[model samples]
Target: MIQIKDLHKSYHMGANSLHVLKGINFDVKEGELVSIMGSSGSGKSTLLNILGMLDEADEGSYTLDNVPIKNLNEKIAANYRNKFLGFIFQSFNLINYKSALDNVALPLYYQGVNRKERVEKAMHYLDKVGLAPWSHHLPNELSGGQKQRVAIARALASDPKVLLADEPTGALDTKTSHEVMELIQGINDDGKTILIVTHEHDIAKMTKRIVNLKDGVIIDDNFVQQVRATQYV
Candidate 1:
């Protein structure tokens, strides 16, 4: 469902240029759950940003669902991003004042879904994430795991083709992280194409495949027997 070849990215600071991704190549098929694993400065975030269309690569090709993702105008890029991708960040990026239901409904609002359908869909997702009871609570009113569940519901409300999660379990305690991963695994089992960018070995192991990155390149990519997060949760 997603493909990249010879991807390269760099950033310039003053006279020096820092190359973040060098010759990266990979593909993710539908119904696969993959994790991109790397340490600090390993270019994982750069790769995720490119995949999410939040940033452009300096070189190489990216095709999402067969659509070329290069040199597109901002308007078209945003449209494609909305239509094909859902993003979950390390930081729960919910608005402090918005209730969980409203936050989940926000994306549908942009997609021009009417109020009735938006609320119904938002509630559906919130219930899917086991947060229907907390729908009226604001972010600050929820615990970290609860907030992340709200974020997950928000991401899923649109039913995008692929789910991109960057350090999805990074901010939670071990138990909470395991609980979140269990939820993520359940989502993947239901056939969502999920890609997780994380440094934690245990977290990476939860995925069906692990692609290790080092110094801006993929060092290893292989599928392994999946480890159920419920074991730890």
Candidate 2:
């Protein structure tokens, strides 16, 4: 359901042009769970940002389910992103002032969903993450795992098509990280296309296939054989 062709992106760090991604090409079909593994400065995050439409590539074409993303204007891009993509971060980007419920409802608000319906939908996702009781709790009051669950709830607020995760388990303890991975895997089971970028071997093993990136290019793309699953984060 996703395609990339001759993708190239670079950054200007003063005079030198630091190439991040060069002629990268890949495809992800519906219901496929893909993981990206790379060391630091490998451009996995940059690739994720471009895939999410939060960052523009200097050149190349990106198509998501038949829609060409590179040609869209900011407004159109934002709309498409809001409607189709969900993001999870290592930092658990939850608003401190807002309750878990309110934070999850924020995306729907931007989508012009009515407050009542959005709250209902938000709670539905929160419930899925086993955070229904913590809905009224603030971020500081929750544990790291709970906070991540809240963030995932917010990401699923609009039932997005692609879940783009950047080191999703980075901040949690072992037990908590595993819990979060279970939740993410469950979402993938429900038919959402998932693309995760992880530095951890355990996290990479959870996906059906892993794509290794180095020097902003795909070095190896294949399925791991029966990865030893670890319980907890």
Candidate 3:
């Protein structure tokens, strides 16, 4: 579902350039759950940004669902991001003033989904995330887990080709983190391809495969025995 070969990126500050993602190569098949793990400056975030089409690689090739992702115009990139990728962030990234329902409906709103269908689709996903009863609650009114669930629902509302989560369980307590992972595992079981970027070992173990990055390159990529999040939850 996703492919990357010889990916490279760099950030320039004045005369010096800090190279990131030196020669990354990987592929994610449809319905697979994978985690990208790395320490600080390991380029996991850079890789994620490139995978999400939020940033362009300085070199190499990326193909998402067979569509080349190099040098896309801003308008085309934004459209592809909307149509092909869904994002779940550690911070939840919800608008505090908006109710959970409204927050979930925001993407659909941008997609030009009509009001009636938007409401219907939003409610359906909120319910799917077990947040239907709290749909009217604002982000500030919900717990950390609830807010993240709302974010997940928002990501899922569009049914994108893949879900890219950045430190998805980073901010929550252990139990809550496990609960969120359990939900994520269930989603993957239903055949949604997911790629998560996280620093936590336990969290990475929950995924079917782990790709370890160091100094801008993939050091290891292998499928491990999947650890079900339910055990921890």
Sorted on TM-score, best first, the list reads: 3, 1, 2
Candidate 2 regions with alpha-carbon error over 4 angstroms: 226-233
Candidate 1: tens digits of C-alpha lDDT, residues 98-179: 9999999998998999999999999999999999999999999999999999999998999999999999999999999999
Q: Give the alpha carbon lDDT tens digit for every residue of 1-233 in model 3.
A: 99999999999999999998899889999999999999999999999999999999999999999999988998999999999999999999999999999999998998999999999999999999999999999998999999999999999999999999999999999999999999999999999999999999999999999999999988999999999998986
Better of 1 and 2 by lDDT: 1
Instruction: Give a tens-digit lDDT track for model 2, residues 1-233.
Output: 89999899999988899999988999999988889999998889999989999888888899998988876789998999998999899999999999999999999999999999998999999999999999999999999999999999999998888889989899988778788888888888889899999998888887888999999999998976534334443
* Candidate 2 weakest lDDT stretch, 10 residues: 224-233
- lDDT (0-100) at residue 204 of candidate 3? 94
Q: What is the number of backbone collisions in each predicted candidate, taken in the order shown?
A: 0, 6, 0
- In order, candidate lDDTs are 0.94, 0.89, 0.95
- The positional error of residue 204 in candidate 1, measured at the CA in angstroms, is 0.6
* Candidate 3 Cα lDDT to native: 0.95
Q: Please give each candidate's TM-score.
A: 0.98, 0.95, 0.99
Task: Please identify model 1 stretches exceeding 4 Å from their true place.
Answer: none
